[model samples]
Target: MSALGAVQPAEAAGGTRAERGDRESLFRPLSAEDGEQLPAEIESLCMNCFQNGVTRLLLTRIPFFKEIIVSSFSCDSCCWSNTEIQSAGRVQEQGVRYRLAVTSRQDMDRQVVKTDCATATIPELDFEIPPFTQRGVLTTVEGIIDRAIAGLEQDQPIRRATDEGVAQKIEEFIGRLRQLKEAQSPFTLVIDDPSGNSFVENPRAPQRDDALVVTRYRRSPQQAAALGLQGEELEEPAEPAEDLHNEVLQFNTNCPECNAPAHTNMKLVQIPHFKEVIIMATNCESCGHRTNEVKSGGAIEPQGTRITLRITDPSDMTRDVLKSETCSVEIPELEFELGMGALGGKFTTLEGLLKDVRDLVERNPFTLGDSSAPDRTQKLQEFIGKLQEIIEGQRTAHFVMDDPAGNSYLQNVFAPEQDPEMQVQHYERTFQQNEDLGLNDMKTEGYEEETGSR
Candidate 1:
């Protein structure tokens, strides 16, 4: 039996089976002639007919992504059939969002892999397919719209019998959806997968697809809890018997890399003339993966802080910098901007941060393989070259760090005298910024009154 609990093909028709590993067993595409037969189906109870039927499972790898298991069920008694897909690989560390512009009818033929954790949205019509509303599927763009139509139409008959007004409104909405199939006007299709398991096809692979924009972002605490990730339940231990500010504390935790038991060592350190900060380091023996994260120990400041430094000398790279989780880094010279949460809180030198940024851009999955475009590739290369020159002290550029939480820091070589090349400014955070940090929703003043009313 394969990993999907189905019979393995004794001999794949035209497909080749790679040597099975402890973690993954890969199967290539099988010839249509013997595809379904060789794999052999397993008897499954049909939901519609309550009779014995066969379910076929095929495990194959996607060209640009990872492996997936495709399954189909059919019942000859009722002629009922269904198809679904499941990601056979591990979930990524960060969630992914794909924005695709559907301008032509041919765009509808592009393939899509939408995991159960993904939500599809058509902004133009304000129509959305929420996660878990339907089973995971390996289908085309058109197929997604068709599925939405099917779902809306499924309940129309009942609504028509009960409420004529609601049914008429739905009928008109369905008509609009049908017109979208014509692809007369361009519309944006967004697929947001917090699990990072979903994928949308790019007809132009190995090259940049101007119509598609992909973004990877760190998951929120709520999202992490929903996915059952570790560290959420671990509360800060009561101040140890020893002074924690001067001592390192170790606690058992699961490794984010391998999901194996590991110990995380944490320490609270007070920066000279600054603030207290907590640092955590974790190492996994199972996967030989090591990670460290820094967190601010104080609450959000009353105003945001922005620091700008003119980098002219190579010595500037040696200056220590502390970047909080809510900070954004920008270098106008390279036309580069890194938003918050790209790299979690980090305490490193100025040079280290730039190198990290370069690595992040270079390691982008879409920049490689068939999805990379020549012009896009050239632009990236040029940008990287300029960044390298800056790192090598061959160029001069202004580096800016903006932290809405007002916790980030950039070292001042001149200390109390203040460096002539740097400027620090403080400003109040906007309502949207406060909302993003969940500050606007907080009720610190009168929660007791609301509770008494309840």
Candidate 2:
């Protein structure tokens, strides 16, 4: 907000997505006018009729903050419902954090927590719940741990063959958490949020002896950079990479599909997140057919790169993903994939990319036309439904992009605090790929540049 936070509507601009500091808001902020009372706890409106509104809401005073309110609303006519947690007090420029010890089951319910841009950790268990990956919620300490467990299971990141030890440790961590929840073990829970909207319930402060530890510190420089608040920008490049980029290869041949004359266009353009790769496009003049493929360029990469993301919520749809021409994308759960030539390199969000796949499969005249077989159309219809399910969060799917050229990325808002599922794995490239990228060449500094094959 504008220094003084205010509860803003969804359409309101300038404020954050989590600001709710109005007088009628759920919570009576610390800076509110003296003796100001809030509106009714429950209310609803007919979004369609406008005149008719119902009272369907639940309001509770959160024990942690003075007069803090949590509310849930539902509409009778449209069946729309939403739960909101309103933060109290003034603008928390530095943010607030909470650390509580969980020694008994009774403490689980009492350890207040707030999160969204929040990261949580259980020190005794060595379990961490990453920030931004989780939906913002006001929950108990137990609820937070439970959510982390669910996230781990839905992600299914552990592989049987690779990182077996890490997988085992994860399992052990989960088991210990269960024990902690049962009050069989004691642990410490830390809730750190940079948004300044979070807090823990602590009655005793500096005045009296207190077990609670509350620390308010300025955001780190790197964190400020990631959050887009402030940071030093990178120095200007000597010259844009594209200016120095050169053509790689070109050839003329009959179109593979139509057997008609065609010219192949090849260029070495740098992908933003990935490395440089040669993009080739062939168009047939006779048949009006086109094909494209991405190949490794320049010196061969020492390792291939794999990027993975789990589609779990609506927020995940907005994640920026880059798939270079050489990248192979797949959704294992749906058994659908695109090889190099089947799709071209581009940058897009998960939502935009999935929509592209749907349009190509369901609306394409070439694929689902009148002459198409009934069985094929039926299968495509089923796949389209699966895609819809993923978008609606009815199902979970893992999206992976494997690029031999190491030129692909699933970008995160906070690069340093990347989620586990959104990862980049570097592995050895295949010998064939090494040859394709021309890594076999030994010529280097001061060596003569040769045009033809040795």
RMSD of 1: 7.0
lDDT (0 to 1) per candidate = 0.79, 0.60
- Residue 138: error of model 1 in Å? 5.4
After superposing candidate 2 on the true structure, give the runs of residues whose Cα lies further than 4 Å from its correct spot: 1-91, 155-169, 203-209, 231-454
* Global lDDT of model 2: 0.60
Off by over 4 Å in 1: 5-85, 88-113, 119-128, 138-143, 153-168, 178-237, 240-242, 445-454
lDDT of 2 by residue, 98-176 (tens): 6777676777775364655678887776677776665556677777777777666554574535777777777776777
Give the Cα-based TM-score of candidate 1 against the true structure. Answer: 0.71
User: Per-residue lDDT for 346-418 in model 1, tens only?
Assistant: 8889999999988866765344444455677677778889999999999999999999999999999998887
Candidate of highest TM-score: 1
- Alpha-carbon RMSD to native, per candidate: 7.0, 26.3
